[model samples]
Target: MRLFHSPASPYVRKVMVTAYERGVEDQIEILGSAAGPVKRDPEIVKHNSSGKVPCALLENDTPLFDSRVICAYLDSLAGREGTVYPQGADRFDVLTLEALGDAILDACLLCRYEAVLRPESLRWDDWYAGQMAKVDSGLDDLEGKWFERISGAFHAGSIAVVCALGYLDFRFSDKDWRSTHPKLAAWFAEVSERRSMKETLPKG
Candidate 1:
């Protein structure tokens, strides 16, 4: 399989992490991409209209996109050891957490694009703050409610959460989110030590 990949994209990191966990990382080909919020990559658009990184083309050239879908597809690959996406009731909880984590990433990416991608003359401080508020609220919910669920498992939910937190540290280093969410910080600390997480650390 070939993937339109970017090292700095948390979503791509999630798919890579999943691929690693499934022991199929070596089977994939990386198609370097320069995807952006304002300007899309035409080559990536051919595979996925969103023109985003983390787009995977299977052996037959069928495209899989967005982190969640790509991760699920990778997790379901034949001959994989165990699974990152479990079966039955627990699966819903895992999926819910994944959605929450992606929501945080969405807010983080929106804030990042606003502050870094948008021109200084056109940037909106209020919009930036609004998106950051969503990130903070999402973190609060994770720390307060989903801590045990996320911390207890090694599923896609945990992958998404870690990638989201990693992106925060990578791009918003000055924010000191750990100061307020110590438990989450500690959990993130431990999960980040995994080989998959270490190897796929985001780069600009």
Candidate 2:
């Protein structure tokens, strides 16, 4: 399998981290690309009509897209019946959590592109704030439930939370969200030490 990757993309990091955690990293190849909004390349569009990074090409030549789809596909490659994603209610819960986490990433990416990639005069504070609100609400929801469990069985949900927290560290370090959500912060600190996560830490 070949994964079209960019180092700075948190979504790709999520998939890569999961692959490493499930011991499938060696089965995949990373293909670096600089594609992004306003700089779309036709080659990328061939695999993903959206011309997005993090699309995967499977052995059968099928192209998988979006971070969620890629992650689910990687989970399937794990071979274990109930390891990365589990089964039944546990699986549903993790899937929902992943959904929320992906939504937060989407908002963060859009806000970033609008502010830095677009001219200042064209940036909309209201639109940006709305995205930030999603982040805020997401953190608040997690802050409440995170304390109830220190280290439950690892699932894709926890993976999503960790990735979302990492995104916060990357994009909003000045905000110091950890200070307010000590439990979640501690949880993230614990998970960060894992080799899968350590190896995939964002660079550049």
Q: Report every candidate's CA lDDT.
A: 0.90, 0.81
lDDT of 2 by residue, 1-204 (tens): 899998888888988888988888998898988788998867788889888978999878699988888878888888876567777666677777778778878888888887789999899999999998998888877878644432576677777778878887887777778878777788789889999889988876
Best by TM-score: 1
Model 2 poorest ten-residue lDDT run = 145-154
Poorly placed runs, candidate 1 (over 4 Å): 78-81
Across 99-143, the per-residue lDDT of candidate 1 in tens digits comes to: 999999999999988888888899999999999999999999889
Ten residues in sequence with the least summed lDDT for candidate 1: 73-82
Q: Provide the lDDT at 53 for model 2.
A: 79
- TM-scores of the candidates are 0.96, 0.93
Off by over 4 Å in 2: 146-151
